[model samples]
Target: MQLAANKGFATEKVLNLHEISHSLEFYANGRLVRNDDGRQRKFQGVSEVIEFVKRNGGERVLVVLPLDRVSEMNVDSIEPTFIADNGALALYAVRVR
Candidate 1:
């Protein structure tokens, strides 16, 4: 969260989901990618990965579209196209097709 903020990628970050749960959004390369509420799901508490992905969900759509909506809680932007989703497969197929 600190790194993202320092980099200007993360506009604001919360230590806990109390306020964020009301509304969560993710961004990537200047686009709103993911939108979710981290409450009432396995992704409880505060996780920057969850926050980041939720922010970039759509851009990662090809590779991140199929995973459980809240699966992002388990990962961060550590790898390129890191979150594997059926959308990832579709991305390859689209290129080939």
Candidate 2:
């Protein structure tokens, strides 16, 4: 999230491809609760998710999945900007055409 913040991407706009919930409860006070609408669709693959985000005004993506999973997907268009020491996390800058 820090990387996204540094790149000026709004936290509300960061789409999680693996998210399955329609809404997230961020806070609650008695009967008052705050929720951010979640991604309702289940993406079949990484490429599809990237395209979806790109179409919705996203410029970058932070992947936290295993490397093997990501390696099996088509990510030729996305550029790797940062990789974690454990290799479990990666941040990519989506190329816009």
Question: lDDT (CA) for every model shown?
Answer: 0.28, 0.42
Kindly report which residue stretches of model 2 are placed more than 4 angstroms away from their true locations once superposed.
3-12, 17-42, 72-74, 85-93
Measured with C-alpha atoms, the lDDT of residue 65 in candidate 1 is 26
Looking at candidate 1, the ten consecutive residues that score lowest on lDDT are: 88-97
True-vs-predicted CA distance for residue 40, candidate 1, Å:
5.9
Worst 10 residues of 2 by lDDT: 25-34
Report clash pairs, candidate 1. 26-54, 26-55, 26-56, 27-55, 33-57, 33-58, 34-57, 62-87, 62-88, 63-88
Top candidate when judged by lDDT against the true structure: 2
- Per-residue C-alpha lDDT of model 2 across residues 2-97, encoded as one tens digit per residue: 444467533433223343322222311121111346223444566775676577676554434344455633556565444332354333333434
Off by over 4 Å in 1: 11-40, 43-97
C-alpha RMSD of each candidate structure in angstroms: 13.0, 7.0
Q: What is the lDDT for 20 in model 1?
A: 24
lDDT of 1 by residue, 9-95 (tens): 343222222222222233222222224662322224324334544664412211212223334333343332232223321110000
